[model samples]
Target: MEKERNITSMIAAGLLALAAVVGAPERALAADGAALLAANCLSCHSAQGGSISRVEGQRKTPEGWQMTITRMQEQHGAKVSAEDKRRLIKYLADTRGLAPAETAGWRYLLEHDNNRVETIDGRYRDMCARCHSGARFALQRRSEDEWKLLMHTHIGLNPTLEFHSLARDRQWFPLAVNEVAPALARDFALDARAWKAWQAAPRTALDGSWRIAGFLPGKGAFEGRMRASAAGEDRYELAIEGRYADGALLSGRGVATVYTGYEWRGSVDIDGVALRQVMAADARGERMHGRQHFADSRRMGGALSALREGAAPMVMAVMPAQLRRGETAELTVVGSGLAGAVSLGKGVRVLEVVSRSPDRVVVRARAEGRDGLNDVAVGSARGKGLLAVYGRVARVEVEPANAIARVGGPGDAQMQKVGVAYRAIGWAAGRDGKAGTADDLRLGYLPARWSIEAADEEAEKAHDADFVGHIGADGVFVPGDAGPNPARPKSLGNTGRVNVVATVEAAGATVEGRGKLDVAVPDFVQRALD
Candidate 1:
């Protein structure tokens, strides 16, 4: 009967294998635990001759089968589902238990290697399992001295670890160093070479305004000029100044030293606070690594790179000669003392001189004042030699007449206001005397007629007796008050009169007079429609 059962089991296993290849093994077995086990396990272990054959025919306790199945699952990447595990265990325990010999071998192997070593998952096992699986020590790559210091720090934090045992700690440290040093040395060698190349290169000049992004504390933008100068091979000086994004003016200067690889050492000052930093470039040039030491001794590491090209001007400052008033004299003044010469020409005066490397002397006529046309001449100093000359006069015109009301009027929309606009027509002389005039004039009225009363007698008396006028957008003017206020009007009417007056002295001849009129508005006019 036993022989017949063995033959039958063999037949069943063979048929199951055929079913797996021909159709569906699970469908044919259909919850039949014995058939499932026979189909799955027969290819690797035969009933009477394989490694598991000795235990295949014998019966074993459920616990023994459970442990055996778990080992297979852990070590062999077996695909048995939870339900299959329970069924397989029940079948093995009931039909073919563990043999005495198999049990003895497994126990002997287990006892000989029972140190409770933890097994890591495949990923971590491949990365750091062999030397030290403890992540606290594995993740760090510090120098030998730093390692020692860190170990002592850990000992203080974890008093139960027996860190004072120098012999044990020392023994393990060398093993870790031996295992990790080669990889670290290889990394450092590559980095060192890169830093050396960066140090040998010339410092690049940053000219123009650059918008600095990715800064800390707060993201800020600034406009400024930058210059970089190399002070020998590895040292450099850098400077930048401009208004910050928040409108505060800023100026910064720093010095740096470059090393092989992309490593740089530098100290920068922002608003008087010094920050030291080490910089490095990654394998890709798109990024830069920075380690900064703050004033409080705290350190932070980050990345930086140029946000755009052509950021700031390379030059420091440029001063272009601009004519603010009278013609720009053609004389070219050279030398360190030329600045002083220019300073002497302030307040409507011009001094013509020859170009000199160190100083300038008046060569011909000293500029007295403007002629009738409000124009100045370019000539040589009285005794000095003649120099080259150029001249240009600035055209000054008054802004809109209404702009004055916006500056000086009351807040109420109903308050009546009036103002005049004028342009300087250059100096002129006439019957009244020498006086300035409104080359072009326009008058504007507010929404309502302004409150009218007698002129401030005391205020009028305080001024020069010869002049009694109200300061208008044009020059000061003299006029009689038009009776009472006009109703709220919208347009101005023309008044036939002159407004500007000037006093002048030329060649011992003194002249005082009023200026000719180009355009004029009556004293009371209504505001215009919007």
Candidate 2:
């Protein structure tokens, strides 16, 4: 009987893998979006018209497409390479991006990287924003029926989603279908006329030189210039040259693909390390702003911007993005025409101007312990810079507030463990009650030790660790076997809730924060629609 159960588990596991693959991204690895979809995906998601009929007339941001691709891979089992995924995302975003007129008021949120919390209204706030960022909802256009289908997909896949702490107090599904879906469709509905006009609009000719300014944390600030020549329609060959804060000359070059009419995606090498660029050109195509990060370690990067030749002075970046309170340090500021004495903003006092030039400036400064993240300004500058002055972390917050993990079944290699990301959100208490408010100081990302344990004594008595497996310092929670465990009453299967904790040391004190994690048997395949 044990052997038979093992064989059955293996079959179930295989089926789950197949299901996930079916939902994954396409596998054609082609640059032609239509051709790629027709060759690989049309076998299942048939194309009735010129495009994949199901996705016809829909528009979303690059991130939304990425989420769609991820769901496809996780739930349906689509297989595609990373490069192919990028190409596909670029294609989709370009073909289905929000029109400029469609995104008028919201573009500010995209160009700026502020930590301000986004506000959403009504049942949608309780039902949707709790799971995804408000930006996700803001950057898409869909018809009413399409929106309804999305709601159905959520309900069908994660039935207990509404029961999660964030939504447990409300009638989630009913409210979502009756109110939320209609509201979203009404507010963000597809502007077919606008999309058509944008498609026919004159494309930006990104051929020539542009001044570039940007910051890379830990590396300081850099001011550079980039020259682009047309490679093809909506594509360009890029060459870059710059100097760091310490007067080190830097050079690199690569190719870029423009999407959504203005969005720019580039693959380049910086000082021999692979880097990816995600920036968007302004409506006039003269100014571009966004960010770039190393392909390997995404955390090690910063903001970037470029301006057309002869344009006004634009500040690109400030190196070492933030300052530690009560500490003195040298700051490198990078931008165009950045002459004259620099201002270090509030909570920071400039001790001396070590050096100054058109593109770079180094200043000796100290930060006051009480100040939070502050914007640094240059006297009569065209663009603003940023800095953070923070002291020891007063508290840590576990993002998402809750998470889920799953146990692997016997003979199912893929189900061995579910990885969970435990990020430490450090906070210095503010005069206001909230940690994210203007007065409260945010310490940003901080290092931490991670662990998991039963949420209650009953779970402890059951020896839940024997079944729930363990979590690693990297924040991944691996679960035990799927079958009933011999550790508890009738071995209540390998399922339960546990606490995920993060411990950090600040100001010679230990700070600990926790989030709830649910461990359960693999439910990769939806049994039935809710």
Candidate 3:
């Protein structure tokens, strides 16, 4: 516990130091949207014939647009005040943002999912994924001509792209211009009925109470509430409070700005820990979903969802999302208008109602029977993708089955090792009663005994586990000391691959989940987006 507090304090202190030196204004003046854009973009972009080139008939998420504007500033020498930049991006996104449906599959790019791998078809994968995430391609709207030009722009920017192994096999430029551009234009066109329909729909309201449910990596699952009241046009002040399943208090206050009537970006400070929310409100504003993470680290984050207080009786989330067979446990249900008798899902029965309210219910449940994806409910409100009940744990799976951990460089005085927080998930065999089958089901996060080992046969002869890192019982793996360890063979640095193992005991038997962790050197160059 003291070690954990020291780590937290170090991170907080580093952030406070950075915050103090950033030298940004205390507050920004309201920007004139029309003037800022025309003055900043029209010069090099050219508004000849009454339309600025590459600006019309295009739409993107706020981050997408923000990236574009940032590229302009960095590469094209475009200058705009930070405050004006925010206003311009806001204006562009509000008027030309992606509809909720358009951003469905590409949200990971914005949410900063570290383990996502692009699975595009061979051709486009060859053309795009070689350079950046495929999601960066999916999160935009453009005309066919603009997409074609985009191909040219890419080749112009990175002339050697055609020389890469993936592109060298074919006529890279022609294939990109002829096939990839047209295909993307079809799939992500600027003009869409969905965007039009969204424009015509009523905007979701912001002032109200919200039930919050999420898992904080290294902290476990939590349920909370937030009060959002309008602060100004398109802005809100948020008051947050909640607790982890283990009874740890989760409290915070933050401010948010709603973009495109649905995108919710908020900065929150919980007990001195800063977190940022990258979520989207439903069209009705009744529910919000996405990830929230540390302000300084993107990979260290977790999924979050919320429901408005006054909405219809709707089951949004259940803490301790999984139930174990033949065992009884306390379950907390959080949602809007949650009242009446509770159904703890298949194989589970409510032994007692500990408490009840319109937005929460506490119940003691007895779970039994075979594994199944269970449905939780509060009377008529049924929870989906929220609860699972399983007999004895058949298997355990650790997320990011493969990951990379970094040891701080010798120059890194603080030895800021890049740690990875892992959680063990229990699973059960499907109806086929077979492990590792396609139908096997997840039973959610579970307690486990964590350990490390050699990654594979070749690694068995290595001293990676001895010199690389140590993982705590809390599932956080902190890398070994920086610089050469004099005791190592030839004073080698701590760098190698190790297997992270989570052992879970079920029915007096142990099931282990293994993941590969590559301990490597730290990155010196960093950026906010990275």
Report each candidate's C-alpha RMSD, comma-separated, in the order given.
37.4, 12.4, 10.5
Worst 10 residues of 3 by lDDT: 23-32
Q: Highest lDDT: which candidate?
A: 3
* Candidates by TM-score, descending order: 3, 2, 1
Q: TM-score: which is higher, 2 or 3?
A: 3
Candidate 3 stretches greater than 4 Å from native: 1-32, 409-417, 480-493, 524-530
Tens digits of per-residue lDDT for model 1, 454-476: 22363233222222224433232
TM-score to true structure, per model: 0.24, 0.55, 0.87
TM-score of candidate 1 versus the correct structure, residues matched by position? 0.24
For model 3, the local distance difference test gives 0.80
Q: Give all candidates' CA lDDT scores.
A: 0.35, 0.69, 0.80
Q: Of 1 and 2, which scores higher on lDDT? A: 2
Which pairs, if any, clash in model 3? none
Cα displacement (Å) at residue 4, model 3: 59
